[model samples]
Target: MLEINLNPFTELQTDRLILRQVRESDAPEILFLRSDDAVMKYLDREKMESLNEARQLIQDALISVKKNEGIMWAICLRGTDFLIGTIGHWRFDKAHHRSEIGYTIRPAFWGQGLMSEAMQAVLDYGFNQLHLHSVEANVNPNNQASIKLLEKHGFVKEAHFKENYYFRGRFLDSAIYSLLKPKR
Candidate 1:
């Protein structure tokens, strides 16, 4: 049987980044990520309008961890605690030892390969610490950067659904990618 326990909250580390639990104080950074047009461009989610919303998001994320349902982390530099991005594995299918991974970085930090480092840390935790059998990502078809990132990490394109989602009064396409746990 699949087992998960995020109790005590697992903090991850890479050479240049740290993945720590999201805190209430991170509301401003979270707000910027959820609200910024460039950051949320392909997310197709409602923009955050206030810090309160970001706080609520943090609470929800914490609840998920407490319940062992999922986990989210604020990505920061090793030296500075400032959050430059966030990443998580959610929408778990524990019966199959599967989960969906999601992540986003501030627009200012783009093109730095920082996300790649963070992703490696998260994947290490998901596969080794969490014992996850497979991980998946749902991405907007137009997001080539994300597509390339997934590809670079050994995730393979699994499917593409044409106009399967309705957002902002229009239907949008989705591309699914997946990776399996590497053999030891």
Candidate 2:
């Protein structure tokens, strides 16, 4: 296994977006993103009810990155610091060279192809820089947009679990998609 650097460089840039470390100043936008029912609809976590919760989340993400357990980034437009979304790889299995990817963008940005751009950049980093062998994504079975996005990035559906996730007093079915490192 590669000796991963948990504290590697913290900024990544695509043509129109920047993925950087989450900050305390991002709390307001984080609160907005996490509190919006539309955005939270498929997420397993509860909606953020206060700015303090957002702050706590940022701190937790920082610690996760520091510990090399996970890496989360605030997605923003190039030349602007306003966070429009977030993307990250968590549940890292170092021995297996795999991790689970998660992301969300503001509702306004949906259907704009921004997420595809961001996911490509992050996948490149995961496979090339981090030397990962595979990356996985979990999505609600009904989330067609997310399914399409993963397909666009060459992820194949690997599993479908009926009512595998219990969220908010209800059981939700999940689809697992995975992309392996391309053969040289």
Candidate 3:
């Protein structure tokens, strides 16, 4: 049986960012971000119309983390600890040693390379702590920034599905990418 230490879930830090679990109190901040169409445009979920909805979402994420079904880390600036984004991994395939990653950042924090740093930490957790062989990401084809970021991390384009996601009253193509840990 594969045993996970769980220590990494406590907190993760990079030079410019702090990655930690989401909390119920995070509802307000999340709502602020989710209320913006620009931020929710690429995401599957609709813009949060109320704080209650945001609270529910954060509560659910917290529950999932506790159940070990997945992990959602709130990304923040190191010094101020401001909630800037979130990164998550879920749909674990233990037998295959793989999982899928998803991420979102506030528009204010965009173009700062924060997602790349958070992704590196998440990838390390997947590859080293979870002992995963591969991690996959799916991005909307029109989300060029995310495509570039994934490619920067050596994730190869594995599949391109046409109009796979019917979102926001539009058909969206998805580009699937995969990254495998280099053999030691």
Best model per lDDT? 1
Candidate 2 per-residue C-alpha lDDT over 1-184 given as tens digits, one digit per residue, 9 for 90 to 100? 6556769656889999999999999999999999998888878788889999999999999989888888888999999999999999889988899999999999999999999999999999999889999999999888889999999999999999999899879888999999999998
lDDT, each prediction: 0.95, 0.91, 0.84
Estimate, for each residue in 1-184, the C-alpha lDDT of model 3 and write its tens digit: 3444444366788889999888877888888888888887777667888989988989888777777677888998988667888898887777777889998899888998999999999998888878888899988878889889999999999999998888769887889999998787
Error of 1 at 111 (Å): 1.0
Runs in model 2 deviating more than 4 A are none
Residue pairs with backbone overlap in model 3: none
lDDT of 1 by residue, 86-166 (tens): 999998898999999999999999999999999999999999999999999999999999999999999999999999999
- Residue 162 in candidate 2, Cα distance off native in Å: 1.0
Every candidate's CA RMSD? 0.7, 1.1, 1.8
C-alpha lDDT of residue 61 in model 2: 93
What lDDT does model 1 reach? 0.95
Question: After superposing candidate 3, which stretches have Cα over 4 Å from the reference?
Answer: 1-8
TM-score of each: 0.98, 0.96, 0.92
Q: Candidate order by lDDT, highest to lowest?
A: 1, 2, 3
Q: What RMSD does model 2 have?
A: 1.1
Return whichever of 2 and 3 wins on lDDT: 2
